[model samples]
Target chain A: MPKTLTKKRMIINIIISLVVLLIVINICTVTGTRSISLSNVLKGPGLEPGDNIDYEIFSVRISRVLLGVFVGAALACSGAVLQAILKNPLADPYILGISSGAGLGAVIAMLLPGISLSFLGGLPIAAFAFTGAIITVSLVWSIGYFTGRSQVTSLLLAGVVINAFFSAVIMLMTLIVKTEQLRSTMYWLMGNIPEKQESFLLLSCGTFVILGIIILWRISNNLNIITLGEYESKGLGIDTEKTKIVAFSFAAFITAIAVSLSGLIGFVGLIVPHAIRLIFGPDHRQLIPLSAIYGGIFLVISDTIARTAFGQEQLPVGVITAVIGGPFFLILLARYTRKVSLMK
Target chain B: MNIIEVENLGFDYGQKTILQKVCININKGTFLGIIGPNGAGKTTLLNLLCGLLKPKTGSIQIDSKSIESYHVKELARKIAVVRQEFVPVFDFSVTEIVSMARTPYLGSFAFPTESDRQIIVESLELTDTAQFADRLLGSLSGGERQRVFIARALAQNTPILLLDEPTSFLDMKHQVGIYDLLKNAQFRQYKTIIAVTHDINLAAQYCDEILLLFPDQNYKFGSPKEVLVQEQISKVFGVEVMKGEISEKIFFIPKGNYIKNNK
Candidate 1:
């Protein structure tokens, strides 16, 4: 697309995205197991006199939608930032082995009896996932630095190696777990929106939202120059290495938080950014906000399908996202490959 | 006063020496060209001047202050560099890319002001890319992309502009265009322009001073007439010069196998 047309279309798409998000969230809230009225959903799930839709709307649907929005936004924005920093369209939060590392930590937590203390159960899971992500990124960075001049190729290769290693550990843990534990672990790995206390989701969302906003804002400058390549960015006065570290750490934090809250949701991060870039012409000032919004919308729609598709069978949301996201990703890869070949 | 002063600059990658005992001073508002063959540390010298690389055993002073004393942002405000190649990972419009030159002036969360936009537009016009301001950088041709990069550097509004092989990928027409652009930036804008190039003739045509780097562990830094001599050209490039001219200028063409023809 021409740059001007893309910018104009981006403004329109951003407006459309907001409208679509509201519509999707509303639909998800009203069309769940207990079908509620749209009016009640709009009023929110709080105390309203003479409202028949209080229970389902307030207690169950609101938190679920909120969780989907927060997780989706976190993943998508992080993915966009990661791809820009790495200078690879294929980059995502999972590419650094963060998801697999988190999975291994969660699997271990599930296996050890004493580790699942009541107050510490979910907290440990979240903490473990956060630690795993940070460790994986740091390890990849150090390995890449040690191996060569710390180019993107070395970093990506390190990620692949670490991912494979973490996956092996996760598979081993899965083999040694009990039947019930195995079922729950599998569900967690497949990714599901759990029925957490409202306070927890709120707190998680608050923390991630603040951090995500700050990161997105801070990196906008670096992202602008980074798109022009690392050498040019440095020549343009960017502290490229420091910028990369900050971007990577922020992305890892958001990804780990999303994983801790739900599980291993995929594709939201990878697809939303590409889609946003295609429309927005790769300016992070616009791309970041649009990615956040549309990522939330996309995930909410996918999760709604997961919950209501089979009428209570409750297929994992991750499976739904994969089913939808995989083909879309292939198309994206095809388009990008064509573009790269044309460049050559 | 010399805007840029390099004292005993030496650098090496591990044990492989790149630049050795290089020292030069560039006055403010002078157009200086550093010409050498491949791997002659031209780019390395530019990188050092731009603070992208720290010299191993020398010092670079900008306006009589040690370069290390200036913050990255402050250095950016003083010196801007344009590399030979800029392959962006994503598609940004010409305006967006050029606006990034204002980064050093912006706070962490600040956006570009109206005055910044005016400067960006003026830079785009200066580089003759204002017509393509809304065009995607990736969509432009190599020469057009080179101009866009020059515009980005100009938008920085720095006093010193360092270009590393700015015309490497350009055709003759665009090469002339870029040379004119650099000359204008120096004469009209009063920028201290230092360019690294392999095109000695182009350097001789436009530059106020030429620094000739030879492979024999020596360099000649002087006016184009003093540096672009037949003997120096023959010795440094290892080519016999059939004919040359220095009538208010310097121009040379290589003599291909004059000894073989005589035999």
Candidate 2:
């Protein structure tokens, strides 16, 4: 409990999580469908991506790894921020119905033909999904403000109502339209990494993830104060209302970008923050960055297992994340509560 | 000089008026206590003074500047507040909470400097929470947690300290302990203090001046001896009380009026 001890421990954890992330990324590249040796994947810029067999496969795997890093980091950090602002440990990007709202948009693009062929080409789904997420979140926020003093409880309830409504819209579409035409949409809803290189998407999502991390980190101390409760934080000189608005908007921004990149990926947001919080303390300074790193490592591992575990048929990465993360989270929570009790 | 000046200040929540036409001036280095019955708007008035709420009418000036003109951090640097209700959600260490008092002085992203650390330690020590510095907030009892919160306010090192029923739910020992700590902070540090307390006797024993309020817009502000009388107590609270004096300090004892009503 000494001051130096806590700081030193935090340093060690950061270093350890970074090292583990690198190892997970390397292992993911080598274990994918087309096996590429670590040497080629690790090689410098001498070899071009489209030049040869190992190079092409390595390039695809590398891009997938990059996608996982951006999407995972964004979702996890957003979850941490949301949890603090909403004062709910269970809150995440999904709480605002972003995932399901985006699902409806993606489903429309899939079931309704000719729309995808517009100037957006295949990217119509991403554009529509982003729009859907923003619309749904803003609606929830407006509802919360309309009902009362912009209470977090009202916002949470609004999110639940919107999420259910979006789910029904998706279901109605499913029942009326045909499933054969919506194969990719179903897979996307189930969560899968981008099949192609998607370098442009990767770059945009990377910008969001990096910039979001920096912004959230600077206000990390504010997040800590906020967890103390709104009035208490304000008493300490924080403009609690302004901070809440900015933090929630930024969280929603990153989460929207994450959903647009990879369809409805779940557990990275829920379980990664919880996992990091368990290992490290609840200080957002630690929670934000550590969750980002651990989240990337976790998704990389999950995606690797999805592609390799079934041999030829690739499972949706979302299923893999939930299947693995859900049980792991339960076990971590059990051990965590026991440890906390023991500390007293 | 007056540390805080309110001229015909009034406030309302939605359409309901809480305080109206209230005027008061709190001088520097004074121990001011606000006592009232249930729903007397003491907390609301305290909230307004701390810039948590904007008055619907009139002006409140702090140190010759209007409260609305100062930024939150600027206001915090001048006045630190101890909240009455403390909820333990996170397991943050006592040191962490106490050090947060320096937040108003530091930049948005800055960590504590060496002097900030010294002040935090001193604050914790003065509040008798230094021993529990490493303990998580959730691990402490209500009294211990209250002390930790007070330490946080002390760490702000502001010229004025505002407390909202800080000792309301505590046992007698902890209540006196907190009051004594605050008194020392006021007398030794030469800080202005304003506490909203429902306990009448505690107000009589500690405060230099007491502001009495009713659910209506009426208020009485003066020394404890002038403000707290049998007539005001009976009229405001609808309860009978007996007043006693011992060791040159006044006390209030309830006459069990509910028993009389039942009879």
Candidate 3:
């Protein structure tokens, strides 16, 4: 059973999470043939942009750590919002087909590198991916109209069908793309941190995350109302349709940004939110911010394990998270499921 | 003065018509109970009253203004509802649940003001749930949960309150306790209250007026004395209920199909 979330406990948990974040940042920076030493791990977290130090390796490591924080937070918060909007605790980018849809968009951007659209600016892939995810989420909800029941089973079915259909489209895209582009798309779809760590990418992603936090916070009260079902929310004078549209758009948009940058990383969205809910209870006011913080911590830990788990050859971070989160999901399913229906 | 006016109201679920041409005029401070058999659209009517559902055929006016003209938050400020079923997305505490009733009142990033806090406290006190305010809603008993919901509705602090079978999940003891609490709030607080109930005796004792929804978009609406006649009750329910009066309250006693069985 989950313990009650008190004010003091929430504060303590947040402080502990910050400490863990610093430790993970330390771990991410320490990379060499030699096993990580405490002192070595502490070395390159220093030196800001344009500062004097071993800027080459240290800067890349720092950038990767920042990327991990950004990607993880975006995905987890997206998951939390989706769960709230759908009124299903299990909804996430991966399960609702956002990742695959975004993956297809990113693949298209890569395949047609010469045919870049000017509107999306520097990150056309990210923009396309965002559009793809938003379209997919809306499609999934629209599909719910045909299913009659909007509760657990029908929503899951809608998500599952969209996920399956999108994956097939992505597979077809991969088959048709140029051989060189196919390899990169496969690596991305499998989930790996890309080599491009431009400061602007970091800045834009950071800005997005900050913006997401503000929007989510502003709507946090509405989220609580939404959880009690559409009638209750509508009866309370909450614009249920408006709240759902805004919240779900953010959820999918956030997931699309992460997918564009880090490939289609699964399980971070699902695993992190559920973990936070157990400790912090289900209030979106706490769940939104805490999930972002804990999401960063969870992904940094997983990414570190991915980089280090295989000697000489690094594993895609997505594989490592899946290996951990698949069983975690099964355990959750076995523990709580009266009916065995879910999206992968 | 009529706080709410429904004119020629009608609705349908899929192909089947639930209520049609139903008219009701409720004055301020009246306790109204809606009673009907299964599938008679008791909840459907409640939804239309609260603006959760738009009427298919007619119009509803609140304080002489059309229901369609009111904004969501504006309507919420004027009226509040406690529905029959709820599926909480998270296992939030009772305090959290009750505090959510302030959603329409509070602006973004606004905490409840001191006045809001006082009302919440009074609401919990009214429902006798102040002692369990900090407890998680999922951990509470059915009766306790129902009271907490009523407390939440009270915190809405609207001129009109609506509930759909508020005591459906409760035991007989708690059922009566809830109606008693509603009765006290009606006289003391002067809030216009509407509820759908299966318990005729409780409704007869508490509600000033009752609305009965029958099949095929038909309805019976009037004061308890006008609507709860023996023939009307038998016609709507399809059951023979022997009635007896105790002082001011009308009580119902069910008489099984002994004549049919004997025949």
- Which model scores highest in TM-score? 2
Contacts from the true interface found in each model, as a fraction, amount to 0.45, 0.59, 0.63
Report lDDT (CA) for all predictions.
Answer: 0.80, 0.84, 0.79
What candidate 2 gets wrong by more than 4 Å, as runs, is A1-15, A39-51, A114-122, B258-263
- TM-score of every candidate relative to the true structure: 0.89, 0.94, 0.85
DockQ scores for all the models shown?
Answer: 0.37, 0.55, 0.41
Better of 1 and 3 by TM-score: 1
Q: What 10-residue stretch in candidate 2 chain A is worst by lDDT? A: A1-10
* lDDT (10s digit) by residue, model 3, range B1-263: 99999999989877888888988899999999999888999988888999888999999999999998999989998898987645366878788888778877988633577787788889989999888887767667888888888888888988899988888878889989998988888888899999989888888888999998886567888888888888878888898888999996888877886645443
Q: Is candidate 1 or candidate 3 better by lDDT?
A: 1
Error at B22, model 2, angstroms: 1.6
CAPRI accuracy category, model 1:
acceptable
- Across residues A48-90, which tens digit of lDDT does each residue of candidate 1 receive? 6455555555556767787888889888988888888888888
Clashing pairs in model 1, backbone N/Cα/C closer than 3 A: A45-A58
Ranking by DockQ: 2, 3, 1
Whole-model alpha-carbon lDDT for candidate 1: 0.80
Cα-based lDDT at residue A217, candidate 3: 61
Q: Which ten residues in a row have the lowest lDDT in candidate 3 chain A?
A: A335-344
